[model samples]
Target: MTLRRLISALLAVPACTMLAAMPVQAAELDPVRVQLDWLPTGDKAFFYAGVAEGIYRDAGLDVTLAPGRGSPDAVTQVAAGNADIGAAGINALMEAYAEGGAPVKAVMSIYSKPPEAVFTYEGSGVTDLASTLGKRMAYSMTSAPWPGVLRQAGLDPDEVNMVNVSPASLAPMLAQGQVEMNLNWVTKQPDAEALMEAAGRKLKVLPLSEHGLEGYAYSLMASQRMIDSRPEVLARFITATREAIEFSIAHPDQAAAGLAKVVPESDPAILEGQLRASFPLIDNEISQTEGLGVFEPQRLATAWRWVAESDGYAIDAIDPAALIDSRFLDTAAQ
Candidate 1:
C-alpha cells in the first residue's frame, strides 16, 4: 500500500477500537418506595422531581412515590414496613411516638416552619385564636395537628363543637355557616382560598405557629430497622432527597413540569401555584441558615411536649431524641 493508504488504515483501526471501548450503561437501580403525607400536590415537588428527572436513579436508587390518604396513614404504613420511607407532618409522627408501638423515626426536617393552621371565611368573625371560642369548627378529630393547635391557642378542643368532615369539605362548610373555622395547612392556602372565593367569600388564615405551636412542620421518616441494618442505604437516600428538594426550590417551574410529567392528572399551572404558596413553610430563614434537612431540637421538643400534654401523657416520660435522628443530614448536605 502507498504511505497515505497505510496511515488511513492505522487511524481507522484505532477509531474502531475507541468506539468499542465506551462504557456500558449501568443495570436497573435499587428500588426505594416512598409514601407521601397526602395526594399529588405541588408541595410534593421534591419527590416528584426525583422520579421525573431521575435524580434518585443517578444516586443509585429507583424511587416510587406513592400518594397517602393522610399523615397518620403515611406514618403507619412506614412503621408497618409497607413503605421504605415516608413523608408526613411532624405532628403525626409525634402523636404516633406518644401513643407507642410505631417503629419509625424522622430522618430529615422537610419543613423548618410548621404549616398547621386554621382558616375561616373573612366575614365569619373568626379572625384568630382568641376569636374562635365556642364557634363551630369543621375538623378531623383524628387528624394529628388539631389538638396541638387548639392547646396552643389556649382553648380546649372539647369546648368547641367540632363537626368531623373530610378535608375537601372544610372550606365549603365554613362558608355555608356549618362551621366557623376549619383546620388545615398553610401550604394549601391557595386551594382553600379558591374554594372560599368560589363560595363568594375570602379566607382568614391563622397559622398554628403564630398561635404557639412552634415546631418543625413535616419530616422524612424511615423505619428504625432501616437505620439499624441499612445505614448506608438510608444515608444515600436522604442525601439524594435533600438534593432533589433544593433543586425543586431553585427551579420551581422545571420542578413543576417534572411533577406533571410523573402525575399527568395534575394541572401544571395549579401545581406551580401550590409550590409557590408552600415556599414560606419549606424555605424559612432557619432552614436557610442551618442547611436543608436540618431539624431544630427545640422545635422537636415543643412538638413532643404538645403531643404528650394533649394525649394525657407526661412529656418527661418520653425522650424527644428517640423520635428523631439527625445523623443523615451530614451526608445529605454533602
Candidate 2:
C-alpha cells in the first residue's frame, strides 16, 4: 500500500479497536426517599422542582418525596426507616428524641428562622399578643411553638381560649368568626389570605418570630442508620437540596411551575405566593452568614430551649448538639 493508504489503515484499526473496548459504566444513582412534613404545598415545592430540574439526578441521587400529615409523622417515618430522610420541625425532632429516643438527627436546617405565626382577619381586633387575650384562637397539636411565644410576650398560655381544631379548619374558623385567630406557619399565609378574601375579610398575619418567638423551625433529618451507612449519599443529597433551595428562592415562579408538573393539583400562582413567603424564613441573615443547611450551635440551643419549655421538659432534657450531625453539610460545602 502507498504511505497515505498505510496511515489511513492504521487510524481505521484504532477506531475499530476503540469501539470494542470495555463498555463505559454509567454511575448508579443512589435512591433517596424523602418524607415531607406536610402535603404538597408550596412550602415543599423545592424538592419537586429539584427532581424536575434533574439537580438530584446530576448529584447521583434518585430522589422521591412522600407526603406527610405533620412534622411528627415525618420524623417518625424517617426514624422508622420508612424514608431515607425527611423534612420536619426541629421541635418535633427534639421532642421525639427526648421522649422515646427516636434514632433521627437533623442534618440540614431548612427554615433557619421560625415561620410560626398567628393569623387573623383584618377586622378581628387581634393585632398583637396583648390584644389576643380572651379571644378564641384555633390550635392543633402541632402548635407547640405558641406557648413559648406567649411566655415571651409576657402572657400566660391560658390567657387566650385555644380551641382544638383540625389543621384544615383553622382558616375557615378564623374567617367565619368561630375563632378570632389561628396558629399556623407563614408558608400558608397566601392560602389563608385567599380564604379570608373570599369571605370579604382581609388577612392579618402576626408572625411569632417577630413577636418574641425565636428559633429554628423546619429542617432536613436522617436516621442514624442512613447517616452511618450512607454518609456519601447524604452529602450528595444535601448538596443537591441546597442547590434546589437556592434555585427556588431565586426563581420562585419557575420553581412553582416545576412543582405544578409534579403536583398538578397545586395552583402555580398560589404556589408562587407561598414560596415567596418562605424566602425570609429560609434565606435570612443567619442562613446568609452561616451558609444554608448549617445548624448554628447557639441557635440550636435556643431552639431546643423553646421545645423543652413548651413540652414542660427540663431545659437540658436532651443535649441540643447531639440532635444534629453536620458532617454531611460539611462534606457538601467542601
Candidate 3:
C-alpha cells in the first residue's frame, strides 16, 4: 500500500486498540530504608501512615520501615549503612558520634523535649522527685539522663538505690512492686498507666522535663553517606515524612489504622492514644517558636551540653553543628 493509504488505515483503528498495543512503563522509585528507635508503636504511626497512604511512593521513593530495639541500635544501623535513615534519640546520636565518631547526623527534629519520666504506682509514696530519694528503682541503659535529672532535682544519683535490669523488665518490676519506680518515656505513658490500673493502682508520672532536663530527644537521623551522595532523594523522603507527621497529628485514628495495617499485632486504639500522647512532645514551646522539624542552635547546644555532661564526654569533642545537616530540610521546604 502507498504510505498515505497505510497511515489512513492505522488512524482508523480504535483508540483502545492503539493503547493496548503500547507497552506500559512504570516510574522508577528511589529506595529508602528507615530504622525506628524502638518497636512499632503509636508514636511512630506516622511513618506507617505515610507508607499506607503512598506518600513516599508519590514522592518517587520506596520506603521500608524497620523496627529497632533501641535508639542505640537505630543509630548503629544508620551509621553502618544498614539503614539510610533512622529515628533515634538525639542524645544517643550525640554520644555515638562523640564517643566513636559514628557517621550519622540528625536531619530533622522529632521530639523537642526529652520524654524521660519516672513512673510509680499509687501507695508507693513517690509523689514527686524529692519523695524518691532513698527508694529502689529499676535502672537500664536508657536511664542515662536520670542521673543528670536527679542532680538537677537536688537529689544525689547515689541516694537512689538502683536495681539494674533490662528494658523489658521495667514495667513488670514496677507493677509487682519489685521496684518502687522505673524510668520510661512519656510516649509510653498510656500503656504504663494501663498496667498500673490493671494492678488496681494509679500511675504517678514524674516527668524529668519539669525537673530541669533540657535537650532534644527523638530525631530523624541519616547516614552521612546518604546525606552526601543522595541529597535529592533524602530531601524528598524528608518532605514526605513531614507531610505524614502532619497527617498523623490531624487524624490520629487514621494514623493508627495505617500502622495497624502494617503491624497487624498492634491495637489501633492503643496506638491512637499513644500518638495523641506524643503531640505535646512534638508541638511544644521550642517547636512552636522555631517551626516544626527545625533545630534551633541554642537548643542543639543545650542538648549537647546535657548529653555530654551526663555521659562524661567533653562538650567540645563534637560540635553540635556537626551533628546535624539542615540543608535537606531546607530543600524539602522548597
In TM-score terms, which candidate is top? 2
lDDT, model 2: 0.88
What is the number of backbone collisions in each predicted candidate, taken in the order shown? 0, 0, 0
On residues 42-127, what C-alpha lDDT tens digit does candidate 1 reach at each position? 98987888767778888888777889998899999999899989999877787787677589988998888778788887778887
lDDT scores in order = 0.80, 0.88, 0.87
How do the residues 1-334 of candidate 2 rate in per-residue lDDT, one tens digit apiece?
6999999999999999998874443469888889999988888889988988889989988887889999899999998999989899898899997896888989999888889889988778898888988888898765577877888877888888888888888889988889889898898999999999999999999888888777788899998999999989998999999999999888898899998887888888999899889999998898889888889899999999888887889987789899999989999999
Clashes of 1: 0
Candidate 2 error regions (>4 Å): 1-27
Pairs in clash, predicted candidate 2: none
Candidate 1 vs candidate 2: which has greater TM-score? 2
Would you list the clashing residue pairs of candidate 1? none
Q: Please give the ranking of all candidate structures by lDDT, highest first, separated by commas.
A: 2, 3, 1
Residue 222 lDDT, candidate 2, scale 0-100: 92
